[model samples]
Target: MELLEANGSCSNGSLLTLSCLSHRVVCQVIGNADPVWDNGTSGNSWVTLLETSYGFYIGLGLAIFSSFLIGSSVILKKKGLLRLVEKGGTRAGDGGHGYLKDWLWWAGLLTMGGGEAANFAAYAFAPATIVTPLGALSVLISAILSSYLLGERLNMLGKLGCMLSLVGSTVMVIHAPEDEEVTTLDEMSSKLKEPGFLAYAAILLALCFLLIFYFAPRYGQSNILVYLTICSVIGAFSVSSVKGLGIAIKGFFAGQPVLQHPLTWILVVTLVASITTQINYLNKSLDIFNTSLVFPIYYVLFTTIVITTSIILFKEWVSMTVVDIIGTVCGFLTIILGVFLLHAFKDMDVSLGNLPQVLQSGQQAPVTRDDKNILIEVDNSSIAPEDKPKALA
Candidate 1:
């Protein structure tokens, strides 16, 4: 009887072990069969929804605010330079680096830096297509400020440019592509390695090197195109670097160890170098050229390059419907037309005959024929002695 009971216990233990193994296998099969169990789709969908809604609006708001700050900063800097010139400082085009010590200059620099910081933060949350075109607002703001504060003229065409810029911006905002989800440094690195992006980067770098080393010294001061070329080409890369660093920063704060990634540091370095170069050349251009001319031309070139770079790197257009793409193109063309108008018609009020008068008189010619015709012709001999003394005094 004892032997039979021991056998029974052994058999029960074996049965229990088999039952546990079978249950584990069944659970594994069910889990494997379910597509959502480990696919990560649900999490991605949630993030996408959040980004498309509040994240986009926040970015757009920040960009608009940045435009105001940056536009104001440009005017302030110009004022500071003018003040320095009044104080016996050299002209900006004459290699006058003395603006460095001016308090107002420093203030303007600080303000610009603040605006750039806001723009940088904006990139982390928004698509570049939206953020970049909205930058045209800066041109409008600068034009307005130049008219009011700097006493620069904004002709009828410039006003039209401002309106077209607004219209284009509105259209772009409405049809802007959704922000691409970049959750990790590895993902960004992968995108960077794509053949299209790699080619674009190589071409940009090569062109920048040629412009800086060869063309800059020869034509930089005389030709507006030289400075613009350098800034716009390198600016495209800088924007990409900004986006990369922004993503790394976002990830780092989200409990990821993204700081340890090499790509993050690379992007940081690229952004600093690119921005410094851009500012240096931009200041040069501003110092030499008219604000109205510089702002619109820079906007057209920089926006074009940046948008092209973003489209290539982020593939923002891949998911867009054909209609959206067409609308974006139309909006962009409108902006280009506006810029052309600004450039072409900026001096419409100045007549061809007035050119010699302005040059000879060393002053702007009167805008109206009545003012020009009202010039007084004084006869000194005909004036009485007492009146002569009063007039002389």
Candidate 2:
């Protein structure tokens, strides 16, 4: 019986040893699973989520909403400026800043800011290739609204242009590049340092200087292209800066403290400076030119430059198939064509001869059915009432 008890005691000891080993293994696993690992997993999951179809849709929806707001803001701001001008404020070229006091101008400015904010958010989830071209929708909206609300006439060709822009926008959205994974400011910095992008930036700066110092003084008022070129060139840098700022903000919210980086601050400053420049020049263009003429031209040029800059900076086409690239190019061209149509046909209804006809005497008046066969009595006062014609029966 003592031997049996010793064997039973040994078995109990072995069981205890095994249980302790199992407990240590479980503890080691729990200890090794650190927060860093969990955080990395979460980060990856978040990126995956942003790269999904739903994220694209979200970006697209925001872009559409932004376009509408921006379009409406244009009309409101223009109207406000007209009111200010009527109130003895100088024109935009004559150093008139009197629109600052106009409540409608303030409202329009706020609306535009909201639209820009929405656009900035969209850059966080979608590629610029998609967001920029979709801006054509704003032009479309502005054209249609101007026709009804602002009394701008949209001819048949202008209508065709709107349709073309819509089709092009649809195609671009379908063929847009997938969002690149940009988790940190360092990644964005690396992109900015790419040789191609740097060259593009240099060229843009040089052109902007030439236009501002030389061309602007000479042709700025008469040539819409001069002002538009400045805006478009500056716009490229602004868009990139906006994207960088957005990424930094996203990283900061993810517990990364990306805003502490110097690059983030640089981008922030750049975004502010660029946007200010854009607003100043865009307002000048609006004040000088018709909204219908300015918007399409501005959109076309701005979109072209922005897309080119995005492609160079982001290498968005690296992963795209050749067919996709071709489709994107075709879509962009179609949008340009549409813009051209809108611009070319905007004044079709207004005839230069109509003014002369109105000023000329003895112009033929419209004949009514009742007056078709009526004979009129003629008075010859110069003939001393002897040459007067009697009324016909």
Candidate 3:
């Protein structure tokens, strides 16, 4: 059973909370609950979930919570981000902020939120492994949105990445594991009591924070603080929503007493915090990077964070063949690399095929040694100044 750590870094606040929600926590909860299915329940596959009252409730609850968190994060992050944008612009010598700004910001947030919500919903219903790869769809979504709304063009590499993501996600979806019988509340809770589970959760949480510490200020093309905050908030909420669904399910079977469970409280709070963080990151990223590149990478990292945690928490691969395990990991890594390559294009200033034409048009483009690096750094330098996000296109 997966056992996530719970009690280290209690001083770290949300960092601690995130650690507690790891897949190990899920396993610990299940094991502790000592759950028994409604009889004739199959293995832990999705199909089995449909055969019982508890499974349905649990799955449904997760789905709803995931949707809620995703939706909330999108709106909150977009609004918060826009405010930052306006503040930045006014400070940076851009003036005359008005209704158009609000309109544009809200509109973008809503659209982005909807897309994220769909992806989160998918995650709740399926395993993170399956849901994660499917998130590649956001690439295509962002591309279309950029072309139609932002007037950005996708060159050959961009188009290739989008198509590959689509094809790969489709394949992964078809091959995802089926659901099984619903596990009881006691089973989930009991597992949390284990030492290993708590240890693992703590370790994962530490790693997450470490990444936040290192990455938020160092490397991203966008605002680091904003990026880290956004990631933290989104992850916190997404994880919480997932836990809340689990609690609600557990409560349904073993009396409403579980409604007041500690895990439940953790879930709710995490969901809110996570959403807040996501908005912060999105707003900052929107300023420096194209939506096509930023959103996909954000989602990719989000998925990676969850699924990687899940692997240890549940010991999810105990039943898998060696080949299957290797293949699954390789597939996930490929998607990550593909996403990186896809986003790399955004770093470049000129579109590949149109480079000659643009030169002929006599545009004094921001040319330098590796124009992409200049774009990323100049944009990044403004991140900490707290301003309205500049459009990168």
In order, candidate lDDTs are 0.68, 0.67, 0.48
* Model 3 lDDT-worst window of ten: 384-393
Which model is ahead, 1 or 3, in terms of TM-score? 1
Ranking by TM-score: 2, 1, 3
lDDT tens digits, residues 1-393, model 2? Answer: 122333454332232222452353211111223456432336456654554547667778888888788777766776776687678777543556677788887887787778777887777767788887777676678779888987766766678889998888888887877756454678778888888778889999999999989998998889888887788888887888877777766666566767568998888788778767776676566556554466567777888888887778877777888888988989998988887787656655433445356347445423222121111110100000111000000
Better by TM-score, candidate 3 or 2: 2
Task: Tell me how candidate 3 scores on lDDT.
Answer: 0.48
Backbone atom clashes (below 3 Å) for every candidate: 0, 0, 47
Which residue runs does candidate 1 get wrong by more than 4 Å?
Answer: 1-52, 75-110, 146-153, 181-183, 217-223, 284-293, 347-393
Write down the TM-score of every candidate.
Answer: 0.69, 0.69, 0.56
lDDT of 3 by residue, 10-61 (tens): 2322231123434422211222235565432434644444434353334334
Using TM-score as the measure, the top candidate is 2
Give RMSD (Å) of candidate 2 vs. truth: 17.3
Q: After superposition, how far is residue 254 of candidate 1 from its true place, in Å?
A: 1.0
The C-alpha RMSD of each candidate to the native structure, in angstroms, is: 15.3, 17.3, 15.0
